[model samples]
Each structure stands twice: as C-alpha cells, then as structure tokens.
Target: MNDLQQQLAAIVGPAHVLTGEAELASYLTDWRGRYRGRALALVKPGSTDEVAAVVRACAAAGVPMVPQGGNTSLCGAATPDQGGRSVLVNLSRLNRIRQIDAANNAITVEAGCLLAQVQEAAAAAGRLFPLALASEGSCQIGGNLSTNAGGVQVLRYGNTRELTLGLEVVLPDGCLWNGLTALRKDNTGYDLKDLFIGAEGTLGIITAAVLKLFPRPRAVVTAWLAVADGAAAIALLGRAQARFDARLTAFELISRQSLDLVLQHIPGSRQPLAAPAPWQVLLELADGGAWADLQADLEDFIGGEMADGRVQDGVLAQNETQARQLWALRENISEAQKIEGLSIKHDISVPVSRIPEFLDLAGTALAAAFPGVRVVAFGHAGDGNLHYNLSKAQRQDNDAFIAATPQANRIVHDLVARLGGSISAEHGIGQLKREELVRYKDPVGLDLMRCIKSSLDPRGLMNPGKIL
Candidate 1:
C-alpha cells in the first residue's frame, strides 16, 4: 500500500478501506450519472470517532475528503472531484435511530438513516416528519440536511433546515461538536445547526441530527386543476390560501410537456383532466381534523373559480390510491427526464407573487432564443420554486444543445436574479454551479461566505473545490 493508503488503513481498519477499481466504482459517481469522478479509496467508518480519525489523517496528508451519504445528489454535490485525489467517506454504515422523544416532538437520528426510515420512525410514534421528497427512498438524511432540501410539504412544514433543531458534527480538524439538544427554543448564540444544514459538506461532516416532528395530518384532499396560465394559478393560490390557511400543504404547477413526459415514461400514469391545458396544478390540503369536509371545500373553491373563468377544468381525487397516482405523475418527472435524455436543469425560486411575471419573461426569452427546444418547466409553485429544464426535441442534436448550457443558463439565471430569485432553490452550489454562484452571488455575500469558510476550515481541506 502507498503511504497515504497505509495511513488511512491505520485510521479506519484496512478491511473498511476499498481501493480496487471495481469496489470503488459506485462511490465515485453520482445518482444522476451527471458526474463521474475518481477516488483514491472508499472508506466506510462505523462510528463518528472513526470518521474524525479519518478526517484528521486526510487533513494531515493534504488529501481532500468527500463525505458521501446515499449518493442521491441531483446537483452532483455528493460526488468526489474528477481530479482523483480525494478519499470518499461513506456514512451508510452509521445508520441508526438513537432516540425518539414524543413529548418534545423530536427524533435523534444518525445522518445515514434513509429519509423513508426517518419518516417511518416518526409515523410509528404517531407524529409526522414532513420533509417528503421523491428521492426519500434512497437519499439519506445527511444529504437532505446538507442540501437543506425543500419538498412538496414545504408549504406547510418548511425545509430541512426548519425541521432540524440540533446537529452533531465532526469539524474539519476531527473534533466532534455535540450540539444534539432537543430544545424547541434556545436563544443561545448563533444557530450553529443552520451553518451545517446547507453547507454541502464543505464546512463539516454532519454525524447525527435532532429533527423536529409535527402532529400528523388527520385528513388530506388532493386535487388536479387545469389553469389558463401562470397568472390564473397565482390568483387561485391566493384564493385558496385565504380560505384554507395552514391546511394548504402543497401547491405544485405542472406544464403540458411535463405531464406528457410522465405519462409516456411512468407506468400507469393517466391524464387527470379530459383535455390537456397549457398549465395544471397538483394541489393538496391537509389538516388535523375530520378531513372529509376538505374535499367539499376544494370542490366549492374550484367551482367558484371555474364560474369566475379562472379554472378551465378540475378533478379531485376520490380516494387515497387515486391521490397517490396523481402525485406519482409529479414525483416521477425527474426519473422520466433521466430516462429520456440529457437536459439543462435549473431549480430556481422567485417571490411567490412574481412567479407569473418571471415565467412569462423567461419562457418567452428562451423560446425566442432556442427555437424548437423543449422547455419542461414544473415545480412547487406555492414556494415560487420551479424546476426549469431545457432539452432538444430530437436526440441527434441533443449534445450540441447541451454544449450551449452556459448560454442557456445566462438567460434563465439573469431573469431569476432580476426577479430576486435564487439560482439554486433547494440544491446547493455543488461543482456544477460553482461559477454561476460566483457570478450571481452578491459581492458582500461572497465575502461573508469566504470569511466563514476560512474561519471554520483554515487548511481548506474539507470537501475541497465545492461550493466556492
């Protein structure tokens, strides 16, 4: 073994270190197949102490460390660098649910637990861990926290950052900070948990977390509404919010193109409306009460909107199965896009009220610039976040179109900036959008980020070449 490998093996037993190409293949790439990297070795540590030791050894050797969870990063944030000089610290073996405090409505869990596992744990205790993402089956809690993930339920429960109360992190220098308190209100200093929640593993390695829980929604009403355009959808959202209040759990926008792709790719997906409209909404209202009345509320609202000529057509899910089927269409969009081909994707967020204007301007500009290009735009409209993706209609010229990604990004990102939207809504600034972050981030914001990075990681060894 080489000097570095020998040291790494000593830190975490040699049996836990994988160096062969075959064994290291899965750890070196991302889930989306967008990034394929080379790693010197893949190390699996069973405990935070071992992780700290590994980090210290890597730091001493000047070798970069890439912390990986379930390897489900949509923005290539969890993958190692292409330079092949880093070691991947796989956290899957550390999966454990440490404690569950029902009274406090908090769960202490290790970072490697799958999101689904966390949700199930919460459900078993008669509470809800409301960060529900499509990738919950495979994505780890640590990765979700690292990205500060926002999902369908963000309209009601907020993002991963809001769901978390405290964290246990291993600093860049291999010292563990035990901040795993389940306190609901602590005015103690700066909220340290916030720093690591969305740091993308650049600041430190999150070992475990104290996650907040909520009362389970006793009733839910799911509906699919056909709208004229973004403007009408925005208007409908206002009306629904005025009526439903906290029961408004989700309000997602779907385009005709996005629906067509899902129906084409996902099995058993059916058209919810009789005719395809230019815009559609997959909305849900949930509450901790006798929710059978919610269906009536939704029907009455949709009827009034239709009478006012705001809604073209609408369909309410009759049962749980129907509701899930409708949701599958929206959730499988990313998978369908993957199966289809390469596309330029942007997860952007503008103000809730400005969504209509932003869409009109961006869609028109993109259509004018790239004629015949398919723009598959859809997302959590209630959160003013859209997954705006562009692809060539034909496969033969897809590569050529993808090569102009920078030019395309300029069009979308410029508008997002003008409308006060984030270029990366939920996804963090991985290597994929590092330059865009540098270009679009405010000068003061960039300087402040640099100062924080320098203060925490002075040696510049933790997940090098990411976020900055």
Candidate 2:
C-alpha cells in the first residue's frame, strides 16, 4: 500500500479501508447512473474520534475528502470526482442511536443510521419522525441532512432543516464541533446547524444530529381525487388546507401521463378511479382521534366537492392496506419512469398560486420546441414544488433527446425564474445543477455563499467542484 493508503488503513483497520476496483465500483457511481468517479480509498470509520483521525490524515496529505452516507444522492452529491486523489469517507459504521428523550420529543442518532431505522426507533417510543421519502429504506440521515431533503410529508412537518435541532460536524481542518443540543429554545446565537444541514458537505462532514419528533398520530386517512387540471388541483388544495389545517399531512399531484407509466410498468397496479382524468391528487390527513371519524369527514368533504363539480371523482381508502396502495402509486412514479427509458428530471418550485400558469407556459414551450416531448408533471403541490420530467420513447431518438438537456432546462428553468421560483427545490446543486445554480442565483447572494465557503474551507478540499 502507498503512504496515504497505509495511513488510512491504520486509522480505521485495513479491512475497513477498500482500494480494490471491484470493491469500489458501486461507491464510485451515483444512483441515477449519471456520474462515476475514482477515489484513492474508501474508508468506513466506526466513531467520531476515528473520523477525526481520518480527516486529519487526509488534511495533512493535502488530499480532498468526500463524506458519503448511503450513496443515494440523486444529484451526484455523494460521489467523488474523477481526479482519483480524494478519500471517500463512508460513515455506515457509525450507525447508532446516542439518545432519545421522549419528554423533549427529540432523538439523537449517528449520521449513518438508515432513515427507516430512525423512523422505527421513534415509533418504538410512540412518536413520529415526519420526514418520509421513497428512498427511506436505504437513504441515511447524513445524506438526508446534507441534501436538506423535502419529502411527501414536508407540507406538514417541514423539511429536514426544520426537523433538525442541533448537529455535530467535523470541520475541514479536523476539528470536531459539538452542537448536539436537543433544546427547542436555544437563542444563544446564529443556528450553526443550519449552515451544515443544507451545505451538501461542502463546508464540513456531519457526524451526528439531534432531530425533532412528534407524537404519533392516532387517526389517519388517505384519499385519491381526480381534477380537471392544475388550476383545479390548486383550488382543491386551498380548500383542503383551510378545512383540515395541520391535520393534512400530505398532498401529492400526479399527471395522467405519469400515472399511465406507473400502471403500465408496475405489475398488479390497477387504476384507482373508474374513469381516468387529466390530473390526480393524493391527500392524507393524520392526527389524534378515531380514524373512522376522520375518514367519514373526508368522504363528506370529497362528496361535497364532487357534487359542486370542483372534483370530477374521488375515493377514500377504507383501510390501512388500501391507504398504502394509494401511497405506493404516488411514490413509485420515479421508479416507473426509470424503468421505461432515458429522461431528464427537474425539481423546481414556484408560488402555489402560480403553478397553473407555469405549467401551461412551460408545457407549451417544450411542445413547440420538441413535438413529441412527453411532459410528466407531479409533486408535492401543497408546497409549490413539482418533479417535472421530459422524455421521448423512440430508442433511436432517446440519445438525441438526452443530449438536449441544456435546451430543455433553459425552457423550463427560465419559466420557473420568470415566475419567481427556484430551479432546485429539495435536491442540492451537485455537479448536475452547478451551472444552473450560477445562472439563476442572485449576484449578492452568490457572493455571500462564496464568502462563507471560503471562510470554512479555503483550501477547497471538501467536496470540491460543487455549488460554487
């Protein structure tokens, strides 16, 4: 082994340090299969102290360090670069629950714990960890915090940023900062946790975190509704929010084209409604009470809307099994799209009220630009974020369509900007959206971001070639 590899092996046993090409293939590539990189070594540290030692060793060698968890980054944030000079630090071995204060309604966990593991731990204590994602089965807390994940429950519980109470991070210079406080009212100073929460590992590596928890809801209900278009969907969302308030936990929008893909690709997945509509909404409400009472009220609400022509048709799930079936449809859209063929995805957001106009304008422009471009639009409409995707089915034409990502992004993102929205909502600006971030980010804000990055990591050895 070389000098640096020997040092890394010594810090975290040689068995934990992998340098073989076969052992490193999966870690080098991204979940989307869009980015692949090489690393000097992949080390899995078992504790905070070991991680500090590894970071110090890499820092002394003047080599870049990429901190990874779960390797489930959709935007290439977890993958290292092609330079082959950096060490990939995997925190999977640090998985552990440090503490869970039921009275404080908070849980402290090591960064590498799977999101599902944290959720189960919270449930065992009769509480709820409101961040729910499709990849919860495999995604880790560190990666979730790094990307500032916004999932289906974001409308009710907020994103990972709000759910976080404190963080323990290892600075680029090998110093460990312990801000792992579970207090909800610590107004001591600027919340340092916020800086590393959404920074995508650019400033430092997140080692552990204190996450907020809520009382488990005693009653829950789920429903699927068909609407005329985006305008109708937004109108329904406003009325639902006004009526249910905080009890409304989820509101997902799905297009007909998107559903068709799911129905065709996913086996045993029958259509939810009798007749298909242009658009659909998956709504869920959860709180304390008898579920039958909530379900009855929701059925009445949907009945009244359908009677008034606001809702075309609707069905309320009568049982938990049925509710999960309904949720499966909404959560499986991305997987279904991936199974079909090549496509480009845009996770953008605008004012909830402007969703309809943005959709119409962007759809019209893309249709004009590419005649057969299939636009699959769906997302958490309640939060004004949508996963807008474009694709063409013809195998011969898929390559050309994929190559036109820049043009398609221009048409869609320019419209998002014109409507006073963001180009990236929950997904961070990894290599994929690095240029897009620079194009749309404000001059003053961009400069401030650069200043913060320089102040934290002037050497640019922490996850280089990202964001800035």
For candidate 1, the 10 contiguous residues with the lowest summed lDDT are 1-10
Note each model's CA RMSD in angstroms: 1.3, 0.9
Candidate 2, 197: how far from true, in Å?
A: 1.1
Candidates in order, TM-scores: namely 0.97, 0.99
Q: What are the per-residue Cα lDDT tens digits for candidate 1 across 389-436?
A: 999879988889999999999999999999998999998888889999
Model 1: runs farther than 4 Å from truth?
1-3, 10-12
Off by over 4 Å in 2: none
Query: Tens digit of lDDT per residue, candidate 2, span 318-405?
Result: 8999999999888889889989887889999999999999989999999999889999999999999999999987877878998999
